[model samples]
Target chain A: MQPFIQFESVSKSFGSMTVIDSLDLTIHKGEFLSLLGPSGSGKTTILMMLAGFERPTRGTITLDGMRIDQLPPHRREMGVVFQNYALFPHMTVAENVAFPLEMKRLPRHEIARKVARALDMVRLGSLKNRRPSQLSGGQQQRVALTRALVFEPRVILMDEPLGALDKQLREHMQLEIRELHKRLGLTIVFVTHDQSEALTMSDRIAVFNAGKIEQIDSPHAIYDTPRTRFVAQFIGETNLIEADVVNVQNGHATIALGADLAAKVRSGPELQAGQKALFSLRPERMRLGAEPAGDNSLGMTITDCIYHGDHMRVQLARGNFTFTARCERLAGDWTVGTQVVVSFDPRDCTVLTS
Target chain B: MSRASARERMGALLLIVPLLAFLAVFFLWPLWTMVRASVVDNTVSRVLPRTAAAIVSWDGQGLPPAQVHKALIEDLRQAEDQQALGETVRRLNSAVSGFRTLLTRTTNAVRDETNSGAIDLGDLDRRWKEPRFWLALREAVPPYTDRNLLAAVDMKRDAGGAIVSEDPGASANRLIMFRTFLVAAIVTLACATIGLPYAMLAAAVTGWKRTVLLLAVLVPLWTSLLVRTTAWFVLLQNEGLINGALQVLGITDGPLPLIFNRVGVVIAMTHVLLPFMVLPIYSVLLSVPRNLMQAAASMGAGPLRAFWRVLLPLSLPGLMSGSLLVYMVAIGYYITPALVGGANDQMISSVIAFYALGTANWGLAGALGVILLLVTMILYFIYGRLSKSPQLLGA
Candidate 1:
């Protein structure tokens, strides 16, 4: 199927400073794509551009098959949820939800029905008569959601919708929204700076940096097979260790950590003997104080031990450098000041040249 | 029980007492004094209140009483200080020739006080007659009559000459007050209608254009009332900028009558008062969050729809406040109308100023002042109630 929304080399600039560089992206229909980055990385700018609030200095955005860059915001037919909820303080939840329909000049009864359905969708039916101020932050957020969703726009854009919520409510709303997206099969582009939020609610994440997308892929693929050092560093708790590629005779290459620590990676064409390389490995993939589990292992001094109930975070020191690894709590025995070996499967680490 | 709590409570009370005292002295005390004056009866030594502005011991209605006739003659005779009346009429000649007629009628009517006065107050009450007052009681009686102020609105004393509804319709009509209220409301609505777009432009634009617009909007705010009104006078004058431009453009070869008319007064007052509307709405619009409009648009509202449904509705608090401020201030305005309006176009404030300054009738002035205050109080109450109403608040 053709992408529902496409950013075709869409670039945005303010005066001379580019806010979004030449970027091309295709948002598939019925998919939740999260644009995740730190503040000032221009994730929210992309969302605003799609919402038609911000005009791109160059290039065009296409929705369905027609170019949408020139369309005024209201005609674009997209839903947006804001971090502050943006519920009209003056109007009751029902009135706020009914506004878009009212603007369309729909009959009163139809607006009432649609508003009721939207409130029910957000589980805020009882709060229909309450003003935004009368509701809690979570309830207000739900009201905002219901208000945006009442007219049934084909696509919804969320700019850090869960940012204003507390941790528990944010997590609760995340699952709720994820379920709604799946049920409705709505195309949603959610923007957030919270990595966990991106991980929890998205089918795929477009990791952004300095107004550019570093990687865009399925959540697991983004976490497991990040193409660049920045992506691997950004997505999860990955330990980056730079080493000399000492040996590469077979499909695997040996990466020397020091006289004390050395590891190997599954062979790749880019790996060369005597060349320096950096490898990223998830802490959870390594077992501390264990015999070599797979093709690679490192011996180190135990620096710190922290119990995480389900897992143990074991910090290791070798020579003058330190690194951390995790193992199942029951499978590992690690104590501070003890020398030990940390082992991981060779397939778990990715060798990055750039 | 707790030191911190005690300290906080003390601090709060310490903050409150001065403000309470200031209000009591400056507002409540003076208002109480005015009410007291309105009712106080002048006795052998002092004035004693029965109710505000209703201290008529003389029940002069229906039939003539000798002492009331004498008192009426004395008061009217004192009012026609032929020398002062001449000067007063001369001063007003430049402004209105009707002043000279008013002076002549007042002088001639008092000269034949017994033969033909407008109304026979002496007929309404009897005890108003006294031998000393028939000869010379103006100094002893103490000049206090609320008649003229009530007369300004076409109301007067009851049969007893105590302040009461004079005309049957006055109980419902409040004619002059209603007229004043209507004018104020129309001006407010007109200013808000014309000023909102300027405020929106000020809020939405940026760079040099925005700065210029902002300065333009605020220019009137920084101007003195005299200068602003003078500027309007210049623009609205027959041979002034607007008329000259119109003539040059061939809209009319002859200058149109623009100044010294009701239309000119209304136009100038609305222009002068427009800043009051624009500032409040502009401030509110500037503070409105950008996301709400975007959210509306993203939810299928176009730009105009988003503005109408979101921006405009959200802007209403400012609109309400601005209109109320403009209307309330306009109701009490005197100078603009006094200079630019005709006799019929003069508002309640102009009448009050006439009684207070031009005529120097303190009792009547005080009564008119009370009425203006009451009107202001009623307006404030309505504004407070309307702003608090859920429907308006929602808007």
Candidate 2:
């Protein structure tokens, strides 16, 4: 099936600074896509360009096989929700939700019906007469969502729509919005700098770095197998240690950390020998026992232990390098300043050279 | 209160003292004095003396008795025969004052002692049934007659005190003030309509476009009202640039009579006050988020529709503020209309000046002034109430 929307070699710049650089992305219909990045990493810019507030410096944006880059935002038939809700300040909640219908000049009765249905969808039907000001932050966000959804547009674009709410309400709104997206099967393009929100809400996340798509995939794949060093360092808690590839043998590359410790890393691609590589590993994948485990082994002293609610994080020190290990079941109580052996399976460490 | 908050509050109060002083002395005191002047007859001097027998004595409860009114009318007539309209113009013209002319009827007509075009009934001592004295006495009613207000409108109700045609030949009603107010309302509405879009457009534009539009709105602001009015004068005067251009373009054979007219006054006033319209609206529009427009645009409404639905409604506050500012300024405008408008287009401020400076009838001037101030205050209040809820400007 044709992709719902495609950004083909799309790039955007503001004066000397580039916001989006030759980005290529495909948003499938009925799919929830999250554009995730740091604050200035062009994720919101991409969403804005897609929503037609900003145009790409070069290249075409196609919606369902036809070019939509030249179309003005209103004619594109996409619903948008802003961070601050952008509810019409002068209008009541019902009037704000009824605005698009009024613009379409729908019959008053149908507008009333649709407005009721939309407000009820967001669980705000009873408070329809109240202005957006009288509503709480979460309620205002729900009103904005209903406003966007009322017109039944083809796609819904949300730019940090839940950023204004507190954590509890934000989490609740996330679930509610996700359920709404599913029920409507509306193609959603959500932009946010919060990685957890993107992970919780998106079917596919496009991780942005320096005005380009560093990697785009399911959240699990993006976290477990990062294509670039920037993506690997950005997604979740990671321990990236610089090392030189000593040798490649039997599909596993041995990386030499120092004169004392040499470890072999397993990654998807066949890595060549003597190349400088960054080894990325999740702290949970390591075993904190005083024994060797396969070809990946290291000696270190226990520097510190952090008792997180779910697990204990053990900090290990070896030479000039420090690494963390998550030991779920603490075995043989180990104190700080105790010498120990930290072992890990070679397959857990992925190598990204750039 | 904490020391800093206290100091800041004190500083605010101190800063406000000058504004309060300015308003109290210049705006409020004059209004009070004008109201005082309208009620008390102090033609002898600015004092009520023990020799109240010489005054135009009237019972504030009912009406003046016939004898006191007789003395008052004879005294005023003797003063009119002496050509003493007021103390100031008596001192102003060295040549015109000494000579006598047919001014008693004009003075009586303007003062409401006689109905418009009605011959003066000379003696109030006669019986009330005598038609002549009865007509004049009937015209002169109570402690405070709205005679000055009528003179301002150039209407004098006849002996019955009902609004009637002043004369078969003389146009009883002025109709100029109504025309002036209509013109002012038109200018205000025009400014709001033309300026609202520019404000919205400026809000959307950024960097160079925004700076350019701001400069466009502000260029007339920086120029003095007189300079702008004069520029209009130069352009509007016959055989001046506009008519010259029209003639050169073969649009007309004769120079258009554009100067010293209502059209010229309106055009010049609009040019002078467009920035007033733009600034309030621009400030309000600037504070409005662009995302609102984007959100509305993305919500399946076309750009114009979204603007009408979302943007314009939100911008009503700015429009109201701008119109109020422009109208207030326009109503009190003196120099622009004086330079550009004809006799028929002079507003209340000009008439107030005429009474104050030309005739030096400070009593009449003060009365007109109180009316203008009262109307302006009322207009301001009505505008505030209509703009929105009071909380908008932190009332």
Candidate 3:
């Protein structure tokens, strides 16, 4: 697909601190792409550069084959939804949505009509005359979304727009925003520190760390086949076991899991014989049973079993190596000091060489 | 209330007692006395009690009856305090001219005819025969009057006791009062024009730059008002630094008339009151979120439009308060105008000063002060109403 927005070797610095170092990124049209990372990981800086609020120290940002690095924010034709909503306190809900239309110098009746439709779209029509402070947080968030969407700009940039909401409301807004993105076919570049939010809403997730992109792919791919240890650990809970590769055969390798324990794991092309390999094993993927299932099985003693409402977290140990397995709460009466065979398919474990 | 909360309330009340007592003694007491001075008149009635009582019966058509004359003579003869009699003479003379000599002659004649009974005041002084003089005496006989308050606004009672505007050229109190408002408005506008941008700039910057900008405003505020006015006085003189710089820069062939006029008064007052305008606006600008401007821009507003729509409206409460502060303080300004203003540029404060100190007419001075206080209170009431509205604060 042709790129809608592209950043070519962009670098941003604040005095001596290099925030975004020599970065290259591309966003496709009508794609809900999320830049997910911890704070100070340069995710917001990229969004700001795209919005034209901050300038890159080096290289170019082109939108639709036109250089937009030199453009001012008002001329960029992009809408930004801020973390705190940034609703105009003095203006009513309708007026806040009508600001961009008025800026475009639309006629009074047209602006009024559009503002009404937009407010109605957000189910905030009854609150059109209320001030931002008079509205609840969810209502205010909807107003902000309506305000950003009222202008119908080329693209929309959201900087942690749902970060301030509570859990339930945040989840509800996430779905609402996802439905909107699909309904409008918007090219959105959302910046957030929330991994699940990115996973739930994004068509593509770009995991960022230390001013660099660790990996960028579909949520399934990023989660199942993370390219680096950072991405594996950042996305979800996983146990990284260090092992020495015994041999690489076909697309799989045999690795030692310490204390005479060995497992067959799928290896990437980078893995070789006699090489140290780290493999990621999700806790839920490991099955605990009374009998060994297949090639990747080990008899381990249960160190601790913790009940987690719907699931049981079984901590297993064999010699010096420890591993966790998540099992169904009613699967068995797994207790500490009980011996169990922990098994996993070779496809479930991917050897990572970083 | 619970015992602990009652004790807390008592502690708060105790903390405020000194303030309340100070306000009552130093502020409310003087204010009450001044207001009373404007309307309470007793000097004439006190010295000529019998005359005051008897004059009420005399018809307005002509001179008083013989009993009034006899009563006036008896009152004058019996008056022991020479100073009190002098005050009475001064009060009566101010009402009708030539009462000074007439009262002096009448007092001498009353003393000389002490052995006789029923001495006529008309016979003692021919001026006393005039009904105007008697009318002045009757008008002054009232224990309380609105004469001073009316005169403060350049209105007075005619001989027939109907309210009328004082003849033109008789007094310029009304003119000075209007001028006071005009000067204050001008200074307030100038301060807003300069201070709004200055405060915005101060609020926009950070670290040492903001500190420097604030210090520029604060340094002038910390300086004595008299010293600041004097600095302007030195800088505004024809051969002073401003003119000298202007002449040296060839801005003008001669020194401009920068002093002893409305220009000098406004310039000095604006400079002296600029901090009042800046601080409020600056603090308010600080409270306004910085992202709002960026948000406006991202929504497709240009810099100027964003400022006009977002920043300016948000800063209005500060601007209003600053304007109110500058205007109220400017209206009552005395020293800056006194030193820098010309004769015709004098405001109501100078008029009040002239009445209070120059002529010792405390009633007129107090009346003028009361007018100022009333105007300020009305404006403050309006400001209070405006600021209390949630829309103005953008909350």
Candidate 4:
């Protein structure tokens, strides 16, 4: 299917500093795509450009095949949920929700009915008359969301909408917004610097780094098979080892870890023999003992042991590099300075050759 | 009601006592004196008590009887001996312009009437026979009269002791009062109109730009009122910079009448008081999140619409407060209007000065002052009440 929105060679620069370097992306209809990155990664800038608050300095942004970069914010008709909510303090919840429809010049009774329905959708019907200042943080966020949705624009963009909420409330609101998107079949472009939030709520996550997209894939793929060193290190805890590629055959590559140490890793098509590559091994994939046959094993000394409530984290040292292995406490404790054999399946390791 | 709490309360009261004493001595005492002056009418009645009493019995339609005339002479003789004749004459002359000569000559004429039987008080001067003179005396005889208050609005009593308009030439106090409020309102509006956009700009920018904008708005406040008014006078005069610039621009064929008018007064007052409008609004605008405008824009409002819907309403409290400040100061302004205003453009404070200093009529000044104070207090009360709204705080 054709993309509902496309950003082709989009670039943004503020004076001498480039914020978003030549970027290209396509968003499908009714898909909840999240732009995930750390601060200053230009994640929010993409959302701003799509929402018409910013224009791409060098390329074009098309919505449903129509060029919209030159359009003013109001003319673009895209709803934006700000990080601070930004609900109008002087307006009641109902009036805030009715603002867009009023701008469209809807009839008074129709505006009333639509505002009532929108308030009801957010379960803010009882607070329709309360000003934004009178509502709590969570309620205000719901009001902001309802206001954006009430206009029924072609697209909706949220820029760290839940950044201001406490952890528990943020989780709750996250699920609520996810459910709302599913129910409404709305296309949402969410921007957040929170990795876990993007992993939990996005249909597809685009990991951004230094003004360019590092990787774009599903959450499971991004977590399990990050293409670059930055993505693997950013998404979750990973044990990285710099290795020299000994040989590459088909899709498998043999890497030399250290003197008298070797491991097999799954390689991409670009892998070459004698090339240096970094292998990303997840902590949970590494086991405490050499068990589970058909897995590669490495001898190491236990450096430290951390007692987590649900699991135990053991630090393993092999030569100059340190690796962490998450293991169930029921599997038996490994004391510090004790010798241990950490093992992982060769198929689980990703070789990054950048 | 524990001992410690009671002691704390007493300590608080002790701390506040000095402020209360200061307010009483400096503020309340002067206000009470002005209020008393507004309604205090005692000189005529104190000196001519018997005549005052006899005149009350006489019908206002006709003159007093023969016995009243004899009693009036007796009172005048006693008043001269008591050295209260001059005061009595002065008080009555305030009501009737010729009463000073009328009363003083009558007192001298009646002093040697011991052998002269049944001396007619009206025989000394044909003016005394006029009922208007007697009516003026009657109006002045009240211990506490509304005469100053009435004259403040250019109304006075006629020969028949009925309310009537003062002579057209002298009855400009009402017009002056209207012009005072009009000038104040116009200046307030002008200040607000100019200040709102300036404050928005100052608040929107940051760093040195914001600092420069704020300083520009506030630097005028540091100058003295007279200096600013004189500057305006120099700028707005016929051959001044403004007219010269206009002439150079070819906007006008000749120099416009910019000075010595209501426009000059309003322009100068607005310039002098604009910082008052700008500062409050700027502070409020600074508190308003910029994201709200962006949100409005994202919600399909254009820039002007967003400003109108979000920023203007949020800044209303500041606008109202600034307007109140400018209006209060503008209504009571004397220097600006005195320096730049035409005779008809003078506001209430100018007339107050006229009564207090030019004419030495403290009673009329006090009455006008009380009205102005009452208006300002009522506006302040409304402001206090409206400030309870959360929008006013821009939270």
How many pairs of residues collide in model 1?
Answer: 21
Give lDDT tens digits, candidate 2, residues A110-214.
999999988887889999998877888999899988888888888899999988889998999999989988898889999998899999999999998888888
lDDT of each residue in B130-187, candidate 1, tens digit only: 3322222222234354554565456765533467556665432256567678778888
When sorted by TM-score, best at the front, the candidate numbers are: 3, 4, 2, 1
Taking the tens digit of each residue's C-alpha lDDT, what string does model 3 give over B224-259?
978887798789999999999999999999999999
Place model 3 in a CAPRI quality band. medium
State TM-scores per candidate. 0.81, 0.83, 0.94, 0.87
**Which regions of candidate 4 fall more than 4 Å away from where they truly are?**
A246-254, A259-262, A290-294, A299-303, A318-321, A330-340, B1-26, B42-85, B92-143, B157-167, B391-394
lDDT of 4 by residue, B123-228 (tens): 6689878988877776777788787888888898766568998899887888988988998999999998999999999999899999899888787889887777
Backbone steric clashes in candidate 2, count = 0
Full candidate order by DockQ, most accurate first:
3, 1, 4, 2
Question: Which candidate leads in TM-score?
Answer: 3
Per-residue lDDT for A178 in model 3? 100
- Model 4 residue B226 CA deviation in Å: 3.2
DockQ versus reference, model 2 = 0.52
Error of 2 at A287 (Å): 3.6
Q: lDDT per residue, candidate 1, A289-330, as tens digits?
A: 556555666677888878898877888888787787877763
Better of 1 and 2 by lDDT: 2
**Which is the leading candidate under DockQ?**
3
> Which 10 consecutive positions of candidate 4 chain B have the poorest summed lDDT?
B386-395
Candidate 1 true-interface contact recovery: 0.77
Best by lDDT: 3
